[model samples]
Target: MSAATRAPRTCSIDAGSVLEQSDGSASGIGGTGHNAAIPSSGIGGTGHENTIPPGGIGGTEHNVAVQSSGIGGTGHDTAIPPGGIGGTGHENSIPPGGIGGTGHEPGVPPGGIGGTGIVAAGTLMNVSGIITAEDYTKKQLQLAKGDQICPGDTIATNQDAKVKIQFADGAILHLLKNTEISLVDYNYSPQQPELNRSLIILAKGDIRSISGKMSKLNPQKYSFKTPSSTIRVIGTDFLVTHLLQQEGALDAGTYTKVISGEVSVQSTTSTIRLRAGESSHVMLNGTQSIITSGGGTCSVH
Candidate 1:
């Protein structure tokens, strides 16, 4: 036949036979009777023993013995193996959304678990005028009715200012005008009553205290201190006042008046116990004495 007038030759191959195309591509059937088509540009088909070229795109074959270098390959039970980049497969370590195995990593945005924030030793239950708290660093933070107070804080009030503090263990303290007090140490754990402790310093001012669980459960651990004396409670409600030496007015001493229960005031030289409606005075020179009254310097009501 002449070159341009020749009829095209046609041939037929069986199901398992190889068919080669002009573009250097081939199609065949594997031992399991699954068809495989390999193209010149490197695309592969599905079969049990299909061999994909180094840079070829693979098909969706179940239980694939080997993975392809190109994309879209699946493994046994349709699970992407450890290093697979993107899929909803169970074994896919690197998924599209997050990098972790299960939930988002710690400290991750919107909502991941990490830190325990601030803890309060007491709270200001009532406040009037300009009440402020000076922290350990001496930075003053303005206090409000519901502000939290921490240990090592010095709570001070301006002239005519007042504040009420409610401790974690149900103790109540009413700090009257021009008062300065420090929460030296306060540790209360209801589950462990034996460990309860409290220590407060009345720097200069008047305070009315209603003893709490710490004073009732561990009285030896609870105490109040002034420059002249240390006051220990016995499930008591008491008023304490520490006045500095002023011109000819109040004496420079620590005064204690018990409204209920009892309190023991101990100076450097002597210790004295007072019951309800009784009072005691401890001078800065460490002399202790009993007094008929607190001179109404502190109000019980």
Candidate 2:
């Protein structure tokens, strides 16, 4: 014998522009209140009784609401009593819906496996140290002290990625993208030989360094070592970049340009000071010439 199968029914209750009242009275969204006892659709009987409870604006009851269009199995027929009103027997089942209200069921549930989880649009991915387009591929990565970064790693533009470096003595370095820089060493100590030092080798990139704890505690402990010379900051901000000269008989040397603050060059034979609007060239002979800013006798670039 064929089992009995019932069709799904849907009824919507519109509490149009109504709000609940503090006096337990039914208030419409438009601030109108009504005091009356609400009636139900039916209790598994042949009757239609719609209701708005005494203290409720609007609500509906169902006997057996089958939202999905599925076949009923044998020995278990589907039946929704008219007036019985479906109770909260099954609450852990998937609700019938589809992507963006499209309602296209691919013979599977809405939130099936291997589906992208729901999330708020325009979410940003924040990370520490350097972050590039590649880093976002994975869920997470570690960025701890004494970490070395290479080119194209953790790369990002001014708006995409950013890197912040804090020195032992409180110096900070903020680096932007398409920028290559190396953190050689960072030491901050106040004892003999003063272990506090900051060495950054800007191979061919831009870096912004801010003098902080180390500079305030011991101003002499800060240094930005590039390919050319060591930049001794006077507790100020500066940008450093190393430009490679054309290839010659041997490997070409590098030149340093100072955007701001004061940088001093100390070589075996002489000591040169560089200020804003000055440049220096580091030769293969370990010799440096102060191009400008009035340090000493040196060749002009």
**Residue-level lDDT tens digits of model 1 in 1-301:** 4212443211111111123334333331221123234222122221112232211122233222333333312222213211111223222222111111111122211000000111256777888887877754366656777666765578898888998989988999999998899986565656555546678899998999998888888899789999999999999899999987752665789989999988888888888888889898888898877886543232221
Top model number, lDDT: 1
Report the C-alpha displacement of residue 145, candidate 2, in angstroms: 15
All candidates: TM-score:
0.58, 0.38
Model 2: per-residue lDDT, tens digit, 74-132? Answer: 11111211000112222113222111111112332111000111111111122344443
Candidate 1: count the clashes: 0
The numbered model that scores best in TM-score is 1
lDDT: worst 10-residue window of model 2: 112-121
Q: How many clashing residue pairs, candidate 2?
A: 22
Off by over 4 Å in 1: 1-118, 247-249, 293-301
